[model samples]
Target chain A: MNSRISAFLADRLPLKNVENHIKKPLPKHINWLFSLGSMAAFLLILQAVTGAFLAFYYSPSPDHAYDAVNYISKEVLFGGFVRGLHHWGASVLVIVVFLHLLRVVAYASYKPPREMTWVTGVLMLLIVLGFGFTGYLLPWDQKAYWATVVGVKIAGTAPVIGDFVAKVLRGGEEVGAVTLTRFYALHTIWLPWLAFGLIAVHLFFVRYYGSAGTPKNTPEDMRSGKPFYPDQLFEDAVAILILFIVLASMAIFVPVPLEELADPTDASYDPRPEWYFLFLFQLLKYFEGPLEVVGTFVIPTVGFVLLLFLPFLDRKEERTSLLKRPVALTVTCLSVVLIMLLTILGAIAPRLEPVPEQPPAAEQTAPSQETPEKAEEEAVFDFGLD
Target chain B: MTDVPEEGQQRRTFFKIGMAAIGGLIGLAMAIPLVGFAISPAFRKASKKWVDLGIADLLKGSRYKKINYTFSAKDGWVETNKRRSVYVTDQGDGTFQVYSRVCSHLGCLVRWDEGKDQFFCPCHGAVFDSAGNVVAGPPPRPMDKLPVKVEDGILYVKES
Candidate 1:
């Protein structure tokens, strides 16, 4: 029976060709750090699978979005667990992708033939962030509404075409039903398609050029490289198993929470972006008024552009070690430190003042008789909104 | 090594091109309706209807009275009965002006401040006078006034 199956596969599929690709020798220096990329890929698959289940019941309108999510979590079988996986999986994917990038930089792996691979990886990271941003609004809760308002407003601070861009993003002047629908479409359909295509290209490049050997490895280690099928594949499988256990444990212990349904007319809610965006949020605090555009757009754009073209910029042939590449190492260290510092600051920043309690309706009458000075003293305005 | 015949090489190239073309055509065919279904919500228009609030006399004098009205909204395959509120202030001249409780600046509900004699938004500190003019805070405009009518002493509001 096994022979018959093998014969059927050999006749229809390129089994031998696939075997030739999978059985290539991998560098001996490949270790746990090298598994980050594969871990991220595993998380993406988890997200797609869990997200498909979520999309089955999610309603993308202002009226029913919140309730649908509630129904899914409380009513649907194992839906809360699936959602927790997707939520935590998204965050973990971001962290793993960042770590993968860091590992590549630390080993000077984005040199020469690996430049295209690095570029595709960067695009994937951006796509992951896009997923986070779009998915945040899917729950249609208070945090989603207010955070998205601030996010779109930040986009509106761009020079020349900021208003146009913001309008296009919102589908109107405000984040309404249309905005929810648009975000839902982008999150569930467009972004995933883009991610899948980019990931395919990224994997193809990895297969074509092979993993960049660690500069820390000796010549003897390079000569004693092992076949990927059993050795490296075993490491990858073990790492993935560990990741699944950790993610499942997290899902079981601390499931994702749902907030109150979005009330656009209520201004009392505090609005803050997701943790990954906290650095940019903190940066915006330092550059207010006319210079807001600098923090919101220019700095991040320039920094990312520089990082994207780092291979071309640092065109040295011999220096592939961290110690040898002082400039690159310093830049990487500084960027990581700056981002961490800003994120910490943003997290600890004071929240907007809470909405003052109102007197019970039964006991109150029109304050038409109050003195202007007393009324002024009693009035509370939202500082964050301004 | 001996090179393959020119005719065989050309045939292989043609076969590869034809296979890719056929595959692409199939992919396009499959994608059309799937993509259309995925993005169908973007093209849907929000259905709005005029809901009756009942009894214009419920709103009398200069006082703001909160009233709840529910209407069904259809979006794609989901139909939801959305309950919304509006504060109707009687002008004392037999004319009624209905204000959406939603603050003008961001979409927070605005409450009438009996002590301050104005509509105050707790979310952003936007203050509006009894006549619905922005007096202080970040509100770019006054409170939104809904299109309201009184036909045979019955109040009706246009809501989406």
Candidate 2:
């Protein structure tokens, strides 16, 4: 009966093309390192599933966002595990994606026909980072609130378009209700759509050009590449299984953190960006005044643009081995080391000390012209409040 | 006969232009409101208000007094208390200095350290003196000072 159903479905559908894609060939030389992309893809799927479950209970408003997240963690069955998977999944995804990029760099896989694939991969990386940035603010905790405040302000340090960038990011002068809605929209809808399109294109390009086999492989080795069905598929599954085990273990063991509710009036709270962004945060401390643009804009922009055009810049066709490619290897090593060092520095950085509490001052007996209710009403009218 | 080909080409060009106009109209129709909706907050002016701190007599002090104030403000769809703190010191000339707690470098709130006699930024190690001048660290300039008024013994600080 199953065979008959499969035959019936296969008659009308493009099942043959799907079969060919599934049974595609990959290089025999490819090892465990080659599974990084698949691992990242697995984690992304895990994130989407976990995030959707969390969203079923999550409220986006500033007033209820924290409470909603708290309810999910404390009350909802298996909710903590889901949230933990999402939290650790994001960090793990970043690492896997970075390692994938490094593997490509090491193998000189971004050359020639794979250039477009590399470009799309880099874009997907940015979108992944965007997911992290936007997702960080959903908890509406002190950490989320302050981190976003500082993060948006960093964009404000840029020259010319800085203020506009900051304003658009915050959705106003400060990180308030508008900002939360904007970030929530980006995290859940807009960014995911963009990422979907990019991922599709990236995968298409990878399929089109086939795997850029190891630098050590000869033409004969490429010609005799193994079928992806059993060998590479098995390897990919193992890598994904390991990743899942680690993710699930962490999810079950480590409960997601929910700090005190966001308090804008609390001046003593020190704001720090997420660990993935700590390198950039630490890098900003080196530049001050007019030179602030270097840290905030120039370095990041120049680095990204360089990465985007790396395939074109290194035009040599004969070189592929890491041992032979001195410049690429050196640049990769330097960037990795510098980023790690900066992240470590940022993690251990001292914060502003708390001020001593003072006695309460006398209260104002007379009412002000702009009463609380009146101020809210006027603001609602001005903002076209929903 | 030669003109027939040119006429055909002209007709094709006309069709192309017509199609382009239709496409552009569709795009504009979708884009106009979408862009406006997304960026409307960029043009939003923060609701400014004069918060009543307290009576002027009680505010007259040698050291800066930390005062917390709450005002109703609209944040997206919710109307809630917009809480903020500021350091105010009587300048002894019947004027008061109201320095914003927000650091000038990034937006991390600065705290007044009684031991150091200066404002210290928690995010970065920025230090500002009693008069709001930048003492050290990465802060570009002095701390921000807000407009202050004393009307009928009530001390009011203008906040945006």
Among all candidates shown, the one with the greatest lDDT? 2
Candidate 1 CAPRI category: incorrect
Which predicted model would earn the best DockQ?
Answer: 1
Residue-level lDDT tens digits of model 2 in A247-276: 878988987888899999998788888899
The sequence of per-residue lDDT tens digits that candidate 2 reaches over residues B33-136 is: 33443344567678798989899998887467888899888664346899989988989899999989999999999999999888999998999988899989
Stretches of candidate 1 off by over 4 Å are: A218-223, A355-386, B1-160
Badly placed stretches (over 4 Å) of model 2 are A357-386, B1-160
Fnat per model, in the order shown: 0.02, 0.00
Query: A200 in model 1: Cα distance from truth in Å?
Result: 0.7
Give each candidate's interface RMSD in Å: 12.4, 18.1
Over the full model, what C-alpha lDDT does candidate 1 score relative to the true structure?
0.80
Per-residue lDDT of model 1, residues A1-386, tens digit only? 99999999999999998987777777777778888888888889878977886787798999889988887676555666667878888888888989999998989888878899988988888889989998999999988898899899888988889999899999999999999999999998999999999999999998888887788667566545665665566566567767877787787688687889888777677777889999998999898778888999899888888878878887985537777788887888899999999999999999887665664343245567768886665555323321
DockQ of 2: 0.01
